[model samples]
Target: MTIVDTALHDSLRVLKLSGMLHTLDARLVQAQAGELGHLEFLQVLCHDEITRRETMSMQRRLRRARFEQTTTLEEFDFHASPKLPAAQIR
Candidate 1:
């Protein structure tokens, strides 16, 4: 069944709460099934919004960084730079 009507969806979009909007249908189902209380439902929604914002912020920062390629220190070829200070690099 559809729990979120158009008005509610538009309201959520206007408030920029995409995470809550995305999960609202499933959460509503859970609430109707008696698996969540009012307080718990609100808490979960707030948590989802916070998580979404954090993830978006991180992605924005990474995109701004504009790294040529993705790599990690662990993937470095220590054997090729044996003469270098591998211990210090690690």
Candidate 2:
């Protein structure tokens, strides 16, 4: 992998580890803005290893939440309900 790709891969790993992408638009990004945009986004983030890890950790936390992945209304309701036990949020 190029530096960009390597950094992006690492950042992505960290994001997954930290569970940040759960909040974004959910799942895959827009179909039209695939590969090329992905590469650009990675490049934009790959400036330095320290910056990359720091950003990955920060954005990963803020970018997405795991609850967004639910499609079922019942599951969504339960996840959204603050009264529900934390364990059941999945």
Candidate 3:
């Protein structure tokens, strides 16, 4: 495994690369073992960052909406509302 210097670690944090930082050690190990190609390692890091941002964005939007409760169509009890158009909603 490669050792990440304090300077580089701080740089990554300053640059807001939390997702990549989180998995850097494991990825480094894979790279050292020749399990991951250079491009693939970068791709994985980018994917992690993208997924993290998307999830955070969604949560922020939901909090801003101030909904009393969040529920999906699948969570709705069809049996509780037999008169409602559950099939059509689905």
Q: Of the candidates shown, which would achieve the greatest lDDT relative to the real structure? A: 1
TM-score of 1: 0.72
lDDT of 2 by residue, 5-54 (tens): 46755776676533322322222354235743676544433433445468
The Cα error of candidate 2 at residue 57, in Å, is 23
Clashing pairs in model 1? none
Over 1-90, each residue of candidate 3 has an lDDT whose tens digit, in order, gives: 225556666877999989878887788789879988999988988888888889999999999999999988999898998999998999
Rank ordering of all candidates by lDDT, starting from the highest: 1, 3, 2
What ranges in model 3 sit over 4 Å off? 1-4, 77-90
Separate clash counts for every candidate:
0, 4, 0
Of models 1 and 3, which has the larger lDDT?
A: 1
Error of 2 at 81 (Å): 33
Q: How many pairs of residues collide in model 2? A: 4
Looking at model 1, which ten-residue stretch has the lowest summed lDDT? 1-10
Candidate 2 deviation (Cα RMSD): 12.3
Give the TM-score of each candidate. Answer: 0.72, 0.21, 0.73
Against the true structure, candidate 3 has what lDDT? 0.85
TM-score of 2: 0.21
